[model samples]
Target: MKTYRDYDDLPKIELPYGKEVSISDSTLRDGAQMPGIVMRSKHKVQIYEYLHMIGIEKLETFVYNERDRKAIKLMQDKGYEFPEITGWARANPADIDMVLNVDGIEETGILMSVSDPHIYDKMKLPTREAAQEKYLNALQYAVDHGLRTRAHIEDMTRADNYDFVFPLVEKILEIDPDCTIRICDTIGYGIPFMNVDEPYGIPTIVKYLKNELGAKNIETHCHDDFGLAVANSLAGYWHGANWSNVTYLGIGERAGNAEMEKLLVFLKRRIKGFEKYDLSCLVEFAKFMEKEIGIRIPRNKSVVGQNVFAHESGIHTAGVIKNPFTYEPYPPEIVGGQRNFLIGDSSGIEVLKFKVQETLKEMMDVHIEVDKNDKRLRNIQADIQRLFNEDERVSCISDEEIRAYVKKYFMFNPIVDQELHRREDDESPDNTI
Candidate 1:
C-alpha cells in the first residue's frame, strides 16, 4: 500500500527508530502566554498528562522565572509522566537557576539573541565576538551544572551574521558533543519555501547544521510570524532534526509557535513508518486546550480544523459520498472527526435526496428513497435552494417539515390534484387504449 515509505526517494530523513520525528508540545508554557489567559498549576498538570498520553516526546512545561517558580515546583512534585520535561530560559545562569531550583527539571533550553540588530542596537555590544562570549558563557554554565542543554540560536532568520551564528553553535558543540543546538526564528520571521540565495529555510538550516555540527544533535524551534511555522518545522524534520519545539494551536508571541497538530498529521498520515505516535488522544487534548484557552479553532486551519472533514461542492460531496479519498487527504475519523455534508448552493439533487432520505430513515425507523423527480420534493427542494441563495441563515431542513410536505402532496391527501383535475375536465378525452 502507498505510505510515507513510498516517498523514500524524496528528501526525507528519519525522526528516529521507533518514530521518524519527535512530537513536542509547548502548550503549557507558550500556549499559556496567550494574552489574558491563565492555566493554573492544576490545569497545567492536566495538559501535561494529556500531551504525554498523546505521545508528545518533549514538553516545555514552563519558563524558569521567579513568577512561575511555584507552578514549576508543583509540577515537579506531581512527577508528570513525560520522560523529558524541558525548561525554557534566557541564555543566562540566573534563568537556568530558576529551573534548577525547581527540584525535577532534567533537560533545559536557553535562548540567546544572535542577530546583529540585538547585539548592536539592543544590547550595545561592541562587536559579534563580544556577543558570542556572552552566549557561550551562559551555555557553559548549564553544562557545568551537568544539565543536558539545548542552545537556542535566536533571531536566526534576521541575523546578518551567520559567520557569528555558525561559530557560536560550533563553540557550544565543542564544549559538549552531546549538547543539542536549535536554530530559532525568534521574531517569527522565517520562511519555509526554499530560496536559492538565502538558505535559512528550516530544511536548509538543518542541513547546514548537520553537515557542520552533526545531525545527531541538531534541533529546531520555529515561530509563526508569516504563518509558515508548521511548514518550517516539518522542513527541519525532513532534513535531519531529532528534536523540535511546538505550542498547542501555535499559541505564542506574535503569530505563535508551530502547532503540534499540523506537524503530526503530516508525519502520521503523509509520512509512513513514523507510525509509533499514539494519536488517539489528539482530539481530546485539542478540545481541552480550546476550552481552557478560549480560542476557537478556525474552520479551515488544517488537520484539526472543523471544516477539514466537511464537504460542500456538488462534485466533491458526490465523490466523497462514494469514497472519502476522492477529496479528503485521509479518513476524517482517523483524526477524531467524522465526515460531514455541508448543505450549500452547490449541493446536487443527489445530496438533497440523500440528506432527506437519511433524515426520514432515522425519523421513521425505515428506509426512505427520495425521488428527485417527484413533483412535491422537487418543488420543495427548489424553494429551499432559492431560500438558501437569498439568506444564509438556513442550512438544515427538518424531517417533520419534509414529512408534512410529503403527506400534503405525495400521500393519501390528493385533494389539491383532484381539484385541479376538476378544473381540467372540459379538456379531458376518452381513452380506450
Candidate 2:
C-alpha cells in the first residue's frame, strides 16, 4: 500500500508516458567491471535470485563470458519467477553470437558506440556508416538468433545529433521496430538545463528522444561523472524512457550506473497512475549486497541509508511526535525503516520529556503523571539521554522496571539522599539502594 498521504491526491499532469521504465540490474556483469571488484558465481546467482524476489522486472546479466553465460543459462533453465534475463554485448555479430549460443537468454543488448569520437577513434570509421552497419548487423544477429535486441547507443550525450541517432534508430526499426533502444549518458555529459533558478530540467534531451520515438522500444543507460545520473534517469522516465540499466548500489564503470534502489523508490512514490512493481525485498537485497558484496552504503544515501530515518532536531521530533507526516516526507516503515529519535545534550527539556513519555507509552500500557520538579524522574531522564548518547542505548528500563521504580519513588520517595551510591536489583529481595 502507498504510505504517503498525498500520493493519490497529487495533481494530475497529463504527460504522455510511452513505455513503462522497466529496471534491469547489472550487478553480476557491469558491477564486476569496477576495478578491484569481484563476485563468486554463487553470490552472482543469489543476486539474480534476489532481484526477482524484489520485483525487478528485468535482469541484464552483463557480458557473456563462459562462466557468466553458464550462470545465465542455469537461471533460464531453472525458470526465474521474475526478471526476464538478458545479456550485454558489443555491437558486433561475434558478440551477438556469444549471447545467442547461451541458449536461453530471452533478450540481448548490442552496445554500439555512435558518438563521433568513438566512431573515428575506436572504430576507425565515419559516424554514419559505422553506426548504421553495426546497429543493423547486431539487430539482425539477435533477431535471427530468436532473441529480443536492445540497441545501446553508447556516449549518446556526445553523439552527433538526432539526425544521426534518429536515422539509425529508424533504420533499426525498419529492420525490427520491436527492438529496445538504450540512450546512454556515457560520460554523464547530457545536461538538462531548465531556467536559471532550476538549471536541471526534466523531459531531458534523452526523454525527448523516447517521446519522439513513441512505442518503438527504449531504455536508459547513464553514468554519474556528474551527480545528475539519477536525476537524469528520473527525468527520462517522466518523459518516456521505459528501460533503466542499473547496478547494485550504483556500482559500475567510473562513478557508476543509475542506482536501482533509488529508481524503485522514485517510481513507487513519484510516478502517477503507475503500479504493478513489488519493492518489499529491496532493503533485504541491499543489505545482502552490502554484507556479501562489500559495497559500503553511505549513511546519507537515499531510502536504504544508515541515517535515512534517523531524526534529531527538537522541532522535527516534536512534530513527528504528533504526526510523523509533519516532519517526514514519507513513513520510514514503507521502506522497512523506522523513525529514530536521537536525544543529546542539545535536546531541550520539553523534547526530552516528550521522548520519555513516548518511550514509556510504547514500553507499557500504563499512564503515569510525571511531575516537572521530581528530581528522580529528572535523573532518570538524564540517565536515559546519557545512555542513548554515549552507548546508543534507548529506554533500557522495561514496563515492570518502570512500574516498580515509579511506584517506589512516588509512594515513598525511596532514597533519602541525592548522592547515595545505590545499586538496586529486582531479582533479589535483599538487594536494594
Candidate 3:
C-alpha cells in the first residue's frame, strides 16, 4: 500500500502530546475584506452555517456596526457548540466595548500591530514602547470586562521577535494566562523551513512561543502574498501551535489567508485525531461562495474545484475507468465530487466504450457491454474525434452529445429485438405445420 511518507531525513517537528489542534475561521471578517466582496447579513449567516457544518472550531467576525451585530445574533441563534463565534477588534477601549456589546461573544481577537513599520509608520506612535503600552492597556481592559482575549500580533514575521514580539507576548500572557497568541504573518513573509532566522522562520516563532513563553494556546494567522500561507501555517502546527486561523476558499486581502478546505484535507490525511471532520460538504461550500456570494473559485483549486476530479486525456481516462485510484489521489465522493471522464480530442477507445455502455444503460434500461474493438463503439469514437479534429471543437463532448452518438451507432433496441425473435420462433416450419 503506497501512502504519503515522512522521512527521518526531513526537518521534523512534532506537535506536543495532549495539545488540541483546531481551526479558527475568519471568512466572515478577514475574508469579507477581499475587494468587491460584500458579505451582507444573510450571506454571513449562510457562510456561518457552512463553516459549522464542516466542523470549524471557531469563527471570528467584525463587530463594528449594527449590521455586524445583527449577523452575529443571527448566527448565535443556531446555538452551535463548536465554531464559537468570536469578535475581531483593534487594541482600543472602544473596539473592546463593541465586542462586549455583543450578547454571546465571549472571546475576541485584540489586534496588536507588532511590526515596527506598523507601529512607527502606519500608526505614527512615538516608539515601540508606546505601542506596547497601548496594546497591553487594551488587553487589560478586555480582560477586566470579563472577555477572553486572543492577542493578534499582526505582522509578526517582520517584527523583532526578541525585542518587541516576545516581550509583548510575555506581558500579554502575564495579563491573561489563558489568552491565545495569534502569530500573524500579515504580509505572508513567513518561511516554513527549519533553521531559518526569526521574523521569517515560522517554525522558530512557534517553537519559542510554546517552549520559551510557556504559551498554552497559540494560533497561526497567515496571508498568501508569497503563496506560503498554507505552508507557514502547517509549520506553526508542526512546531507546537494548537490553532490555525483560516478563511474559506482563501478569500481575503491580497493573496488571501490559508484556505480552510485545503488545510482541513491536509490535516485529515497527514495527522491523527482529524478523522472527526466531515469534509463531504467542501464542494458545496465552494459552490455557494462562487454562485451565491460572487467569489470566483478557480476551477483547478485543490479539494473543491471542478477540474480536481475531472479526467480528460486518453491514458488518464482509461486508467480512471479501470481504477479511479490510478488517476485520483483520493475518492471524489469524499469531497462531494463525482468522477468525470471527459471526451475531448485526446479521448481513446476505452473511454468511448465505457461511455457508450453507461449511456445505453441509462437511456434504455439495457445493459450492453461493448468491447474496445467493437465496430459500433469505433464508429462512435470516430464521430467524436471528427468533432474535435475536423470540426475544430475545443470543448469536451457533453454526456448528452455522447448519448446522441450512442443512439446513432447502437441502433439495436432490446424491446424490438425481443419482438422480432418471438416472430421468428412462431414462424418456424414445425410451428407453421
Candidate 4:
C-alpha cells in the first residue's frame, strides 16, 4: 500500500481552483468580536508577522479603534508586505474616512446586510432598495477617496440572492470592476454540500456568483456554527472563489471562522508548488494566541493542537514507531509539530522502552540506553501497566512518573548505579530526578 509519506509523488485528485489560491486573515476584525477575546496590540502585530511569514496574502482588520490603528502602523513600519493590510468598515463615509487614516490599509470591507432581519430590523432601513442604496453610496465614497472596497454581504446565507444580493453586487461593480465581494455566512448557517437550495448550499451560491454574476474577485468569510467553516470555504474554492478569510485558532463570534493553520495545511497537500511555504511559525503562533487571550484549544484540534501527533495506544504506537504514516496522515513536523510517544494506559512494551531511552538520555550524564528485548524493560512495562490497570483513579502516566519506576527498578545495577547514586547524593535538582 502507498503510505502518506508517498502521497506527494503519486497521482491525486486536483481541485478545480485555477492554479493559485489566496488566503486572508480576519483575526484582527471578526476574531476580536468573539466574547472574552481582547487581543492586545503587540500580540496582534506578532500574529500579522506570523501569518505573513506563512504566506497568507491579506489581512482584514478593524479600523474601528486607536489600538488597531497603532498595530497596523507598526506592521507597516516593519515592512512585512505579503499580507496587504485591509481595514473593515461600516457602510458610511465616516467609517471609510477612519480607514483612510490607518497608514498602509488600502482596502476596506463595507458592511451590507441583505437578510430580512438586518434590512428591516437591525439596520432599520425601510426597504431592500434603501439598504442597497446606502451600500452603493458608501462604495462610491470609498472609490472617490482612492481606496478599494470589499462589500461584505453580511447574513447572506439567510438573504434572498435573486432579488437582493445580486442586485447590490451589480451596483457595487457598476462603479468599479476592481472592487471585490465577500460572501459572509454570518450566523454559520451555510451548508457546504451540493444539491441544496440557493443561499443554503455552498456550491450553488459560489456557482451563481462565479458564473451568473461574473464576479471579478470573490472571497469566502465562513463561520463554524454548523462545524463546516473549512468545508464551505473549500467548496467556494472548488467552484472558483479566489480568496478565503480565516483567523488564527478559528477564534471569532460564537463558533468562530475557518482556522488559518488548518486551511494552509489543507492547501499545502492538494496544490502543487505550495511546499515552499514557511510554516515553521504556525504551531508557536497558535500557542502565542492561546496564551495571550486565555482561550483553551482542545488538545485534539488538528494542525496546531497538542495531541495531533501524540500517541499512546499499543498497536498504533508500535506502527508509528516503525513509520509515522502507519498512524498519521502526514509528518507532524510538516506544520512545525513534533511526534511524541506518550507513556500511559494502553502503552506498548516498546513504548515503555522508548520512554526509558529518552529519560536515560535527558537526565543522565552517561550513555545507558534501554534495549527493547531486555527483561528489565518487560518488568518495567508490567509494573507500569499495574499502576494503571490496578488503580481505578489513574487515567494516564507521565514520562516523569515512568522514570521514577525506571530509577527504582533498573538504575541500581552494579556498573552505572554507582555514578547515578553519587549524583543523587549530591542533591542537585537534576540529580534528584
Candidate 5:
C-alpha cells in the first residue's frame, strides 16, 4: 500500500508513466570517488542495509583488485536482503576474471567506449572498428564465462548513435539478447529535454536505444557536472529506460552522480508504489557517512540537508503556521525530517509571536498565550533585525538569546527574571555564518 503524508491532495501526474522506474545505487563505486571521501568495509555494509530499507532496486560493487574483492566479500558476508549486488568493470578479460573471482557477483558492467573521444582520445584506438573489436572480445569473454553482462557505454552522449553506437549495440545483443545497456553521460554533457536529433538529449539517447536499436533494460548513468544528473535520470525513465544509476549524496568524480534520496523522492512524487519506504533512514545514513568520512553536508544541500525544511522568513513561517502545505511541497516526515522555524534577522512579527509562545510554553511549563500584536514581540523583532543586520552581524538569534531577552523584558514588568551565564562556544563553520 502506497502511503502519503501531508499531501492529502497530492499533485498527481494524471498522464500515464508507461514504464516502471528502477534504481541502481553506486555509492561504493562512484560515491567513494568523491574527492577525499572514503568508506571502509563495515561502513559499506551498514550503508547497504540502510539502502535496502529505502527500497533500493539494485547495487553495484567494483571488482578492480584483490582489496576490492575482499571488501566485496565482507559486505556480502553480512547478508542484508534486497538490492542485489552486481560487479562493475571495464570491458576486458582481466577485469572479467577479477569479477568472476568474487564469491557471489551474478552480473558486471562492460565499459565499452563508443565515442570518438573515448575511442581515440582515451583508448587510443585507430578506428571505431578497432575499438569495437577490443570491446567485443571482452564482451564475448564476460558472457561466455557465465556472468550476465550490461554495457556501460562510456561517453555515450558524444557518440554517434546511427553511425556506430546502434551497430555495436546490435552486435552485442546478437551475441546475447538479454544484455542491458547503461548509457553513461560521462562529464555530464547530456541534456534532459526531448529531441531525437540532439546528440546529447536524454530522450533521444534512450529512444534510440529502446525504440530504434531494440535494447533491453536500458539504464542511465549521469554525472552532475552541469547540475542535470537527476533531470537526465528522470528523462531516461520518461523515454522508457528502466534503471537510474545513483549515488548516496550524488558523490562521484567531480560534481558527482544523481543523488539517491532526491531521485527516489522525485519518482515517488510522480510514480506510485513507494509508500512503504522508510525514507527517515536516509538522513541517518547521510549523517553517518559525513561523520565516518570527514565531509560535511552543506546546510542548503537538497533532501537530507539540515536547512531544506528550515524556514526563516516571516512570510513563509507565518504561512507555515496556517498550513504547512501552503509553504512547503510535502511534510518533512515525508523524508523523515523535521521542520524548523529558524529565528534570523529576516524573521517577522507573526513568526516571533509563534516562536515566543512555543518557547515560553515549554520553558515556563504553562500554556503561554502570545499576542501577535504584542509591543514586546515587535520590539524583539526589531532588536533581532538590528543585531542580526548591523550590531552582532550573526546569521541567526539563538533560542537562548531569545529566552534571555524575554526574561529580561519580563523582569522590567511581570513575566519572569533570570540572567544565565553563557558558556564558551565550540568551533564550527556553521556556527557564525
Candidate 6:
C-alpha cells in the first residue's frame, strides 16, 4: 500500500484551463471598499509585499488619489517581479488619466457597465448604443496611451450576452487584441453549473468568450452575496478563463469576493501546475492582517483560521492522538499551522495527558511522558469536568491555568525538585549546585 499526501491520487476533473492560468489579487482595491476598512499607503505597500511573498502574479489598486500613487511608488521601489501592480478605473478619460499619472503602471482595468440597468439607470445613458460608445472611447484612449486594458463587464451575469455583451467584447478585442475581458458577477447572481443558460451560467459565459469572441485573456471577478464566489470562479476556470480575481479573506463590498487563500490552497492541492507556489506564508499573512491592519480573522476561516487545527471533543482527540489523519484532512504544517488538542469539557484523559506532557516540555524544559491511566492526568481531567458540571464554565481552560495545575501535580516530584534546586544554585554568585 502507498500513502497519498494530496489530492493527486483521487480522480481528477478534466478542466479546459491552459497552463497560463493564474490569480490576480484585488485586496487593495475592491477589498478596501469593504465598509469600515481603511488601508493607508503604508498598509497597502505591506500587503503588496505579502502578496508577492505568497506568489501572487498580479494585484490591482485604485490610483485616484495621492495616497494610492504613493503606495504604488513604494511597492514598485521594492522591485519585486511578481504581484505586478495594476490600476483600476472607470470608462472615462479622467479616470484613465488618474491611472496614467501613476508611474510604472502598464495596465488598467476599464469598467464597462454592460447591463441595461447600469447603462440606463446607473449611468443615465439614453440607450445601449450610447453605453457602448462611451466604453469604446475610453478603451481606445487607454490603448492610445500605451496602456494595456482589462474591460470589466460589470453586472454581466444579468446582461443580455448575445445582443450586448458579445458585440461590445468583440469591439474591445478589435481595439486591442491583448485586452483581457473580466467577467464581473457584481451581485453574485452567477451560477457554477454547466449546461445552464447564457449570462447567468459562469461556464457558459467563459466558453462563449473564448470560443465565440476569440478572447485571448479572460478573468472572473465574483462576489459572495450568495456565498458562491469561489465556486463560480472555479467554474469559469474549468471552462476556459485564464485569470481568477480574488481578495484576501474575501474582503470586499457586500459579502466580498472569492477568498485568495482558499482559492490558492485548492489550486495547489488539486491542480497540476500550481505546486510551485510556496504556501508557508499563508498563516503569517492572516496574522499580519489581524494584528497590523486590525482585520479580525474569523477563528473558523477555512485555510488560515486559528481553530481550524484545534480539536476538543473526546472522540476527535482520541482518534487524533492515535493517528492524526483519522480526524484531519491534511497536516497543519502544510499551511504553517500547528495542531492543538484543546482541553475542554468534552476532552478525555488522552488529550489531558498529551497536553500535560506538551506544557511541561515547553515551560520547564522537561519531557515527562505519561499515559491515559496516569493518576495525575486523570485528576486534571476530573477537575476540568467538575468546573464544567458544577461551576457551569463554558470557555476552555487557559494555558496559564493548565501550567499551574501541572506545577501543582508535578513540581512535588523529588527529581523535578532536585533539578530546580540545582538550576537555582548554579545561577547564584557562588556557582554552586
**Residue 334 of model 1, lDDT score:** 63
> What is the C-alpha lDDT profile of model 3 across 128-174, one tens digit per residue?
99999999999999999999999999999999998878998999999
Clashes of each: 3, 1, 0, 0, 1, 0
- Checking candidate 2 for backbone clashes, the offending pairs are 21-242
The 10 consecutive residues of candidate 6 with the worst lDDT sum are: 5-14
- Higher-scoring candidate on lDDT, 1 or 4: 4
Q: Tell me how far the alpha carbon of residue 39 in candidate 6 is from the true structure, in angstroms, after superposition.
A: 1.1
- For candidate 6, the per-residue lDDT at 195 reads 94
Candidate 5 local Cα displacement, residue 326, angstroms? 1.2
Better of 1 and 5 by TM-score: 5
Runs in model 3 lying further than 4 Å from the true structure: 1-18, 412-433
lDDT of 5 by residue, 94-130 (tens): 8889888887888988889888988888888899999
Model-by-model lDDT, in order?
Answer: 0.72, 0.69, 0.88, 0.83, 0.80, 0.88
Q: Residue 66 error for model 1, in Å?
A: 7.2
User: Considering lDDT, which of the candidate structures 3 and 6 is the better prediction for this target?
Assistant: 6
lDDT score for residue 384 of model 3: 77
Give candidate 5 regions above 4 Å deviation. Answer: 1-6, 14-17, 196-198, 274-276, 415-433
- Model 6 residue 54 CA deviation in Å: 0.7
lDDT tens digits by residue: candidate 4, 314-378: 89888888777778876777788899888778788877777787787777856676678887788
Greater TM-score among 1 and 4 belongs to 4
TM-score for model 4? Answer: 0.91
